[model samples]
Target: MVSKSSPHKSALKEKEGISQPESIGKNSVAQIIQFRKQQPSAQELIDGILKGDKISLSRAITLVESTQPKHLEKANEIIQACLPYSNNSVRIGITGVPGVGKSTFIEAFGRFLTAFGKKVAVLAVDPSSTISHGSILGDKTRMEELVKDENAYIRPSASGETLGGVARKTRETIILCEACGFDTIIIETVGVGQSETAVHSMVDFFLLLKISGAGDELQGIKRGIMEMADAIVINKADGDNIKKARMAKTEFNRALHLFPPKSSGWQPKVTTCSAITHDGIAEIWEMISEYLILTKDNGYFSERRKDQNQHWLLETINEQLKNHFFEHPEIKNLLEENKKAVHDNEISPFAAASILLEKYFR
Candidate 1:
């Protein structure tokens, strides 16, 4: 009673007179502004991306793909803000056998789609050398016409030892492209065996390209890939291979029937096309649209996307965990020692892995 009111009054006055923690707050704001100045503002870049500004989109993709810690934080913030504006674009993954002419197909398909007034973004994932960690970066040169098209945006990325011929950053790059308002996104994966499954997980539709007369169609690809594809296009079908292409298409069509139907409740189709002459490109696009309509009507379209998101989350977590494990100095030493042990036959491969894992947990 004697001091309660007095103390409260004094405290209020002291609080009003005292300086606050403005220095830290001011520094943070200044840092954010500086970071923004160093990188493109997400909102501004996103706006340009939506308007089909190729330069802005390229810059935005590069910002997202940057390895700088600060740039990564900004990229995350931008993606978070742009998430609501995303998911409006169609994502298609295209893969083929090494000589199946994936680059040619993408160029022809991209030009065809743009001709219909749709903006297309092509993201090519090139295989990186395990020894040098460098990529050939050849997509732009292969798709010269599409690269020059104002309505088409082409970005080539290195897989960097990642599985599935897709970059670890490809998913994030896809989000940036969608946020920027690309109507369609085409992910072109390096024609690696079995690893093509990675691209299958991210796309709304998976199209596999195979050249006719490559021996038995099944010989050219694993059965697992054939099962995963929504559509199979026998490429190089224009010249002397037309008959063989048709025969190959029939073989695939028959093979497709043996597998259990997709969980998406849609049947996969097989077709033939020649990417070099641009023959049957329009038909392939039409089939894609038809598939979309059928899936959307059946309520499988959104469900498929949700499933892809879940798969991506798991993939991202596993990738990060692997990176962290390999980067730890102690783990690196252990791995090196284990490799030597295996090479010298001092330990079985399984035992070596077990020893390393035991130490990893410690």
Candidate 2:
């Protein structure tokens, strides 16, 4: 008996008359692997990104997201080089519950911006699966047209175990996108209605995206998120849903009025839009433009960016300290011992943590 050789199939002894050929040729596979092996240097990536090269921009962001220590140093160099070019872009953080047409709305909005020569970069952060550790949403695929646009860039990232993880990487990616000449940065965060969210702290404008019929949904959302919203866009207002959308707009506007005025002195606006029909898309941009004007004139724009910088400064410190603490060889071994000790009630959790911290410091 002869053996069958099909890369797609498990190795088996041939009993049949014929065997299928390899799905992909070995030469093709080698070429693909060789193409992927071409990684540009940090300086090259930075230079290409500054020249508005999307490939380089994406590559640099990949470095930023990598957990490897070597990648960290390169990521830092790219960020430090790009910092001066950043903070000039309009950073918008958008959030909504699942199935709210967030992707559809973004495509319409992004296309509208690019119509006027604005370079838009979208960072859609999907909730990472605890088991798979991969992004569940295909935002780039959803925003197909926008993804094809030369002026628009859509990069979806996975939200890790905590909000802080998303913040550090996404915030750094924003800098890279801005340096890549994307004037408008849209960060789509995971879930709805979290208080003092990482996205809220990093963006200049926070927009809450929602559907028309969400009465029960409102209860699930926290007031803190509503107060943080610069605008509420009720999407999918086409057909019979128009009336419900308008009603939702009115309800959101009223609810917004219930809160005290924003420090920006710019009132939060509620508007209805149909992401499918592109209705009210321009009006939404007009509203955002009004906001930008008001914030800039009142000096809130620059002040808010400064505040965000300070917040990120502290956030980075906390993240690095935590990483440093756990990465210590003594702490990793001691942590396991401490965990067992605490589980056995042989030592208090505080005492174990104290012992680990002392060892880490030493």
Candidate 3:
């Protein structure tokens, strides 16, 4: 039989060992909570955004983009707090060929808008590697003038594991920008063909920027993007390629006529612009404003926004399900085993996937 004194001493030692660390952990957590409370809350960030403060917008976007667990909770809180003020801005998505001067055009356009007393926020979606899931946030460096402007906010974000050039956080960032009272939100995307669709889905206006003489006019853009574009601007119009730009514009105009009208009932327009000389930037903005006016007047604005919101809800649910499924330890083990089986041809790839999925469902 064990001695009463021995058991009590053992229990006391156990308590001493465990309780001290637990107390320290609790204190540390309490300190962290106190620090967080002393720091800016999401409500304060929203207030700053509504005041058109660029620093606040930057901080809010960073919070939304962070992958940390605590930051995710904070981001959600910030988004919820800002939701009432969001969706009030004109969201425009811009895409173009690799060398078509997307950043330059955005800088010029952003500067132009700021000059006219409009608050503009640029959210650039950098391409991410499918294999490594990394991105080079190069747009902020490229858009030097826009980054320095008091009325303009520039955020370059990564697409991470998302397939589209647009980052998963981009939609949230747009809402934050809108909450901050930015009148216009410009989403810049890598000009990869199908990736532009991601940008198209979230914005009110989808602008396709193309340079003249890149290749055959007909095949310059993939069919899907051309079909989605609200406007196609032929850039490099001010230089020696002015004549070629005109020809390209004519070809695009004719090409656009063949596609079905947009769901918004506003006909797509093709124009020419030179970002190097800052020419036709105002015209492009005017075209966008006109398109917005027409869509809003025809009641398509609200309809499109509603559809986007529903789509976002479904997207969020799907993403969460995917994350949850992948996070399960059993599912992960089965997936690895299945991948090896598929590699070794022990079972057909589809059969392996079905078997693993059955296990997951079970």
Better of 1 and 2 by lDDT: 2
Runs with alpha carbons beyond 4 Å of true place in candidate 3: 1-44, 130-132
TM-score of each: 0.81, 0.90, 0.84
How do the candidates rank by TM-score, highest first? Answer: 2, 3, 1
How many clashes show up per model? Answer: 1, 0, 1
Q: Assess each prediction's global lDDT (C-alpha) against the native.
A: 0.83, 0.86, 0.84
Root-mean-square deviation of candidate 3: 10.9
**Model 1 spans > 4 angstroms off:** 1-38, 41-52, 218-221, 329-362
Cα lDDT tens digits for candidate 3, 161-205: 677656458889899888877889999887775668778889999
Better of 1 and 2 by TM-score: 2
- Kindly list the per-residue Cα lDDT of model 1 for residues 241-346, writing each as its tens digit: 8999999998888888888988778899888888888889989999999999999999899988898888888887887778677777888999999899999999
Q: How high a TM-score does candidate 3 get?
A: 0.84
User: Of the candidates shown, which would achieve the greatest lDDT relative to the real structure?
Assistant: 2
Off by over 4 Å in 2: 1-28, 192-196, 216-221
Model 3: lowest-lDDT 10 consecutive positions: 7-16
